[model samples]
Target chain A: MLGIDDPWIWGVYLLCIFSTLLCLVYGLVNWNKEGEQEALEEKEEEAWEESEEEMQQKELGM
Target chain B: MNLLLLNIIILIYLLATLYLGYRGWKSTKDSEGYLVAGRKTHPYIMAMSYGATFISTSAIVGFGGNAGLFGMGLLWLTFLNIFVGIFIAFILYGKRTRKIGHNLNAMTFPELLGKRFDSRFIQYFSGIVIFLGMPLYASVVLIGAARFMETTLAIDFDVALLVYSVIIAAYVIWGGLRGVMYTDAMQGTIMFVGMVFLLFMTYSHLSGIVPAHQALTDMANLVPAKLAALGHAGWTAMPVLGSTWWWTLVSTIVLGVGIGVLAMPQLVVRFMTVKSNRELNRGVLIGGIFILMMTGVAFTVGALSNVYFMQKLGNISINVAAGNADSIIPIYINAATPEWFVYLFMLTLLAAAMSTSSSQFHTQGSAIGRDIYETLTHKKGGKSILVTRMGIIAAMIIAVTLGYILPENIIARGTAIFFGLCAAAFLPMYTSALYWKRATKAGAIAGLITGTAVTVFWYLFIHKAEAVPLGICKMLFGRDVLIASMPWPVVDPILVALPMAILATVIVSLMTKGPRDKHLAECFRGVK
Candidate 1:
């Protein structure tokens, strides 16, 4: 009643969020090329994989 | 104001509370009864206590009123509460916390913290932090209930606060934790029934929304431009994305409360109250239902208030007169609803506020009296019950002072500060204690210190100055880079601080020798 607009505007916003995330993927190269940051990412990737595998095994048992 | 009826209701409520306290006083003979309610409570009572303790006057008055300002978008928080805060908390955290707590024979939060780390220092320090932090939270609950009374009965705000405070303090001081839980059950029932009735009334008033919206849609462009600046394309819908409204809604309100609730010290202690993990598993349904009604109904009614205000007042919407968002729910209740409904809503709010406040007061009081006082000073008091009762009085005074003095923000802001602090302070340590065999005392100390300090630093210094400055004095001397550039900092500390605490606890615990305490191995066998 306060007159913002159609309820479907919410739908447009949700779509924009997806597009924004896609843009961020394309924009990732613009981030600083620091070696330490790269190393940190690789280290985190390994940890993530290990944790993921452990979790999968736990799920299989359950 | 119908002074006589209001007076009689308040007086009778007060008298009943005192008599109940006296009855509890006769039964309480030892430290065990005072703190843990003899550990033989039914799931229903414990569930009510858990629900009551979590849903406060802040939720009813502060968040309810916010629905008037924000539309129904805030309903997400209620959903988060039942699903994440209540269901998962009991189903996952409660079962584990209660087992560990019962194994340790812990009575207070600090005791749990201390026992977990094999460090009396950690427990004692945790107690100090809880005592220091909780008054700010407790006082807001007092202010919320007082605001409702002031609006409904035409009572002075100060007078309402004092009356409510005295009644609660008297009962809590005399009766201790069991008395608090008994009254919480009574109060929870009052809140449940009252909110349900008010929701029905608000719906009837707002049911005419189709007509009202038709009337307002007639003048769509005439909508104020300021609201666009207020970050909405329209009131009937959610906030515009990337607006300040969206950020606060998503980052702070929804995510903060959703993730943050899992770590609340008062709630975590509720987990410790029952006999077994099964009791906790049972509490999930009970807590879920209570949260759904208390929160779901408030938001539904709040969203409907817009239609009511627009139709009756010939305005497109209602603007909150007071700067404090806590006043919004009271304003809607008073302005548009029938007078009889107002009285009932007041009682509902009193129940909501008192139940939460008493839990907070006792939790904080015990944190100071039994946790820190017994652990550090080891003053060897002959009568600990006397000290515990006095601690309750002191806690009441601190909360009373804060409630009367501090201005209101939305209730969620205070809730965030306390729960955020809890999550930062205790969550990582608790997780490790339950499952990670390597968790050391030093690692716990790091996690607690790093998490708590960083959370306090961020919420106070980085967040906007628009709301009340909840403990920013310390950050004034310290530096903040994020606040310098942005209007307000968007950094929610949990995203940053929590992981740091977890990582630090794990890394440091692995580096150090496991706990040397004799009780350490026995604790792991508790759940087994």
Candidate 2:
């Protein structure tokens, strides 16, 4: 049977698999970061509060 | 007997898709909702949708068929899909794309670029390229799905093509991005489950992974003479280095699609669909798993199919039995699986086709309607939506026409060509726009033009693959390529075009003055 004799070739294949697994692990480890729902809601609220302040200041000037 | 059950299942799928379309229609109150799902999509939905759009029948049927012929070496593409298409795309590109897209209120990829550069030409030009290039890619998806149906259902090829096109077009035109993503999530689930079963069944059929690969390797003498001439060493091993097969596999297929994923307008627009970077981040693992199952399984099963065919049919190769490489997967599934599983796999294939095509139609429609016509005319509100719908219809027609005309064994080549074109034409300028503070409007335009021009010139003139069929070089110069002295006869366009584009961008930016301070401040706001 014609089989792969080179150890380095197998190493490359293993490396590819290992890298993919590493990526998967990286993704799983960082599943819920500070960048998801709570952070987005906080940013939106800040924007809303700033807009409301600006409107109130405009009314006071008038 | 089974046809009636298959029909019922398809009818159910159609009804579900229609219902989702109605929900999308209701959710779409304004242009933003229709275009980018209002940028509040959940991580699960966004992740699944991105995976579905990114890995379609082109990966399963087209590239799977390729793996069957070319062997396990195609697995490198699987690695690239996960590493580049999913992880890097989400972490590096998706984060910045989402932030800047939100900051500029950009609806499409072209709009994001245009708004970032503060130039209407960059926006309209990229839109026009998407409008032109995406149809060929869409047509390949359409052809892949139709080929599967024709083999599985025993329907006329023309009828299958028409039915596939009509169903996907209806949802895309009526429901927009929301409808597209909703269907995509469901479709992605079906594809994952179907592929998992396929991989398991393939391994079991071959008596296990080691023996299966050993059998394939033992049959190294079975390599077609034509393929061997092209430097194919064996199915399991990488082709001889720098051989035509090696170049085709590495440069054209692997690097082309791997790098091309970053610049796809349909996929890039997906990053903007999520709410926060966390939602986008959450999508990374889900997308990773989904792509792994879809592509990893496809390449494995595709290669193992040779073992199955060899054991059963004596001497008939996959290409001989299926008549064409594109039809090999369906032919093998029909022979290998039970009746019930075949029916379910059919839906999985349909999901694969519809999800990708719907996104293509939507991206092209937005390119034409929102990016080109509306931006140029300064139109907004309901009028833009009307234009987009019309553009979707136009895209569907063009894709269907091309689907009918394309040749067999074209699914993989067509996919590679489009991906390669996108990489050459858009990747450099796109990456620079996101990361480079010194990138000027002049530089972006010059890069865009040079990249597209060089790729087209090479494909039409220098590359024997297209030149032989196009006959342009043969007619003008009595040879396939003008420069007959070149060592490599068929170098992929990306190898040459990408570097030229990158060089032009860097050189032009250095020569030009900095972009307006006001524009830079607004564009890079909150982007540290």
Candidate 3:
């Protein structure tokens, strides 16, 4: 009988908790920074902006 | 009985979903917008949509049922889901996929690969496989949700399945990716809350996690003798290594899903929906949390249900719903949760089914409409959306047919089979297209053909569970599998076929010409 008192069982549970907390902390700390704009080539930036405008216009039309 | 209230709530939910689909329809003025949400979607929407699509009712109900039988070892899948399915996916694959998709103006996963290799054959081949293979997965999701309704609402199973199918088709055909994502975000939230409540209720019922697990572990002797023969050690412990149970656990269940996540067309396309790598990075944590709650709680609750059943009936078996393991969670919910909360959980189940099925339908539709037809006819724009809509209807019909006919315990196996198939067939070429500049078109085609061929051959002839279905080996060779000395039946096709695929890619690429330097430069542009 492998019970909750078993060290191996506790190890598994702890690993899960540790991994989940790591994700949560990392996410919260870097949330804003991650979605910040990245530098793009001028040519690529113009094309991206044009598409973004098109998307906005289409949404407004809807 | 609150039946009328349930109906009204369900009706209102349907109307809201339809309204969202209509909004998506209005905004979808072109092919790019319809297929990929204009590729400018917010990180939150992308994350929720990705999470919801990945963790369907099958994970909650079917795999939850599986957890009841397999025990805590299944938590390994949750770790993989967060690590591989979310973090690695978002950080590694998502960045490259989005950048290359933008560079190539590719709208679908197969198209992304096809354009990368400059091979129309790769495009059409992938499209056909997705159109054919995805229905098995989608139908299982449909059955999972319908079973919940049948058990909870007392509706006939067939009727529940039909109604569910029709409603999902209505939204997916109308809304495209935008509609799917919008509803998925809403659905994802419902799933998160519902699972959290179920977890708390479970722990509170057993007093606490420690007590619940302790009780479950104490009942290890209660494991059926037949299961013990198959190498089930105990609920709280991993199976004995090199045992048949271990093979099934690692090869079929764990690796089949863990590695398979990387190649999923529906999940992969979500990476391309966002604008930049930043959006993917932002999505990583939310996706991880969503997967953790969705899968972790389900597995825990599943194992603990044995304790609940034991306390209530002096028996510890998932036999409440006619001995079907798939119904363990649904039946448990009926016995455990308050009536009002059951109604809320019903929405959660529906969300799980619809979110995943809609993505499948949408992807399959796009595969046929954009990847296949557009590749052949060279049509573009609003016309492509029309073709996709038609394809959605076709896909729904096929999935609904499969939903009606599939066998018991098909939920977990069906999900695994599709994931395994995708991993075997697509992962090698897809990885090379992103990272390996020396990969050739001939190598990709060889890997694709050989990989798909081997998986089909294995599933039809050699796979122990599936051997008799086709009856090729049983009739001709007087045995199910040629490798009688090895545990061919227990080993997953992915364990066999994925390596073969990589081998095929490497050998053929070494023998043939590689991608053009200009093409490689363009594909790898800004990739670092």
Candidate 1 chain B minimal-lDDT segment of 10 residues: B465-474
Clashing pairs in 3: none
Q: Share of real contacts kept by model 2?
A: 0.31
Ranking by lDDT: 3, 2, 1
lDDT of 2 by residue, B1-528 (tens): 289999999999889988888788888866778899878888888999999999889899989988888877887888888888988999999988887887787889989988888889989999998999888899999999999899888999999999888898888888889999998988888888888888788878887767777887777888878889888877677888888888888888888887899898999999998877878767887888788788778876777687788788865346555557787788889988888889989999999999999999999999989999978998665677889999999999999999999888889888888888888888888898789989998898889998999988988888877778889989988888877653345688999999999999989998999899898887777675
lDDT accuracy of residue B43 in candidate 2: 87
User: Least lDDT summed over 10 consecutive residues: which range in candidate 2 chain B?
Assistant: B314-323
Tell me the lDDT of candidate 3.
Answer: 0.85
Runs in model 2 with CA error above 4 Å?
A: A1-16, A36-62, B485-487
Q: Once superposed on the true structure, which residue ranges of model 3 sit more than 4 Å away at CA? A: A1-9, A34-62
Please report the TM-score between candidate 3 and the true structure.
0.94
Q: How do all models score by TM-score?
A: 0.83, 0.94, 0.94
Model 1 interface RMSD over true interface Cα atoms: 17.8
